[model samples]
Target: MRTKSEARKDAIMSVALEVFREVGFDAASMSQIAARVGGSKATLYNYFSSKEELLLEAMLHSAEQHAENVLQLLQTEGDFSQQLHSFVASLLTLVNAPETVEILRVAISVGGTTDVGRRFYESGTQHVWTEISSKLQEEIKKGSLRDVDADRMAMHLRCLCEAEMIRNLLGAHQRMSASEAREKADCIIDIFLHAYGSTR
Candidate 1:
């Protein structure tokens, strides 16, 4: 039921995300995004009023997709441990992608100064935390996970995992390899199992 314009917007936004990640906000130009998207700068401007707007839109788009995906995973799956595992894997897949690192790096550079920066944190990063927190709450209620406060658990998970992950993600080889990510995720996952895995 989506319109062609909507599809085109998605395409433009996707390209913009890559460009923003690559060159960053201050370095990335509208013309560069237009060239990447096969459009003129004028045309790109018509769709988005400014660089900040486009970046914010792309950040929101990524967040919305992630939230929807995690929620869907929670709804369709019956196993709490499996859902947590799947969520961790999928979330890492998103975060470890080269482009995603670019986005986060660029955001960290601009996050203190722009509306888009603020929106990205509020809507994208924090939103994921909120969704994960909700999922944890549900699992606790179902007695599939240990009974713990969901928000604190969520924050702990984010702080313990993602905070360290940024250093790994931005390391010299360009990004974390699959094996490396597995090792990193496994360590925290054990903590999750200890605290939340089903106990008889």
Candidate 2:
């Protein structure tokens, strides 16, 4: 049920992401994105004010698409350990993908001088944290998890899950395989549950 304008914007962002990946962000131009999107530069400008804004929007769009499944996994009926494993595994798979790694590199490269980092955090990562925190709060209320600051707990869980994976993304190690991601997730979840489960 998207309006024409919304649909067009989505198309523009999708094309922009491709262009950004095909050419590094610093080399990408609005003109290139507009060309690929089948629109004039003026039309592209109507949707995005600048290349930075478009990059941020495109990154957010990609994150949202990847998060849809993770969010559902978090909310699914299951043991907390199993659910956490599923969520983290799915998240690692998405974040470790080459396209996502490329976008993240662009975000990091421009983070200091541009608002792209802030916008990316607020629009993408923050939303994921908020959703996970809410789910944690529900689990605490049900006595499956210990009573703790849900937001802080959620952040801690994310940090643990991303510890080595982030290094991998930064090229410290090879990208993790699905089995490796699940194994890592299981270990993190076990540690998390031991510390935060109701009995603890």
Per-candidate TM equals: 0.84, 0.91
Overlapping backbone residue pairs in candidate 1 total 0
lDDT digits (tens) for residues 71-166 of candidate 2: 999887768778878998888777677777777777877888899998899889899989999999999999999998999899888888667656
Q: For residue 175, give model 1's deviation from the true position in Å.
A: 3.9
Number of clashing pairs per prediction, in order? 0, 0
- Residue 53, candidate 2: Cα error in Å is 1.3
lDDT of 1 at 63: 70
Off by over 4 Å in 1: 177-183, 197-200
Colliding residue pairs in candidate 2: none
RMSD of each candidate? 2.5, 1.7
Which candidate comes out best when scored by TM-score? Answer: 2
Model 2 TM-score (2 dp): 0.91
Q: Residue pairs in steric clash, candidate 1?
A: none
Q: Which tens-of-lDDT digit does each residue in 152-180 have in candidate 1?
A: 88888776556545565456424556666
